[model samples]
Target: MTCSEPARTTTGRLPGGLVTTTRRIRRTLAAGPRVVIAAVVKALGYRLVRVQYHGTLGEADGAVPRGTTVFDDEVPAVANLDPALLGALREAAKDAANDGVEFFVNSGWRSPEYQNRLRREAVSRYGSEKEAARWVATPGTSPHVSGNAVDIGPSEAKAWLSEHGARYGLCQIYRNEPWHYELRPEAVEHGCPPMYPDPSHDPRMRQ
Candidate 1:
């Protein structure tokens, strides 16, 4: 449907009764063969690397710095989160804890310097700097840069979250990275793609 067309529910209701859906059929046409090729590659498991908080990379490591406090720590910077989203997450965590699954925020809000250092380290180890880009996003492009994203719980909690996180406005963005979740509704609606780097030719790449 065209963007100007008013959305309607199947039951012929308007307002909150209807869900707004956006289609990118025309945008895909303009995106050309590359988008299709990328989709195919993604389907074939030529997927991006999953980064996690406190994950080790070689001896020096790269992910989030060790010993950095989680978002739920004392005097939390909960202001970094959207209020509604934060409340939802807190309720979700409490619910999980009630179910005997402990949930905790592991990381949030990365500085540009930290992201840059990670990008540089990944480049050094992987050889192809472009390859590094696939895993460690450039500073401005990172969701962590926005301070609205968080890595939650631990490795063991992955399965539990996969089964139940959606009830609380959280979803694992990367299939392989269980800890990461974002407050963006678009992420939930679109089915969270792994936080891969923007394509090399993407205009944002130059930044």
Candidate 2:
């Protein structure tokens, strides 16, 4: 179909193979600058859009890091975090190592099924949905399911991350869990937003 054809449809698929290009732009804008640039290229009528078309734009330019063993599981665990996040962690770990600190991953990139199981376990461990929500998130809503959250460990590492992680867009989002971190690249420019007090206070965890 021509650009003159109705661009709006329930599917949001534009004629030149721009499936959901409009929503893609919004998500791109929300995700970060690199993805936004990818969307901009598409918005400017470029049909050659590639790589950046994934919902999160594939680490600014398809630069996913090779998985490596670390602590509990490994890099790119069962679900695999965003490559950019993995990259940042690698660099941070190197710097941390130089300071005589060792970083370790307690959990990373859990499958949705795994997340739900954890939630159920949390309910069992914590005694109620309310208490469980204070720690674990529901399946679809958890950043771990989306490969966007990680739980790091070893007190020294958490301490170093607390002091230096914002430099790499990794931040402890929940005040209650210092080991839990997420990539918010904007943190590099805008300063790590603000903590949510706990998962109970995080709006995303309300599911």
Cα RMSD (angstroms) for every candidate in the order listed: 21.8, 16.5
- Steric clash pairs (candidate 2): none
Clashes of 1: 0
List candidate 1 stretches off by more than 4 Å. Answer: 1-79, 186-207
Per-residue CA lDDT of model 2 for 1-207, tens digit only, reads 112333333334457445456666777677887667756665655544234233332222122234322332323462277778778888898899999988767777766666777799899999999999999999878888787887787899899999999999999999999999998899998879889988889888766
For candidate 2, the 10 contiguous residues with the lowest summed lDDT are 55-64
Task: Give the CA lDDT, 0 to 100, for residue 30 in model 1.
Answer: 67
| Global lDDT of model 2 | 0.73
Give all TM-scores, in the order shown.
Answer: 0.53, 0.63
lDDT value, residue 168 of candidate 2? 91
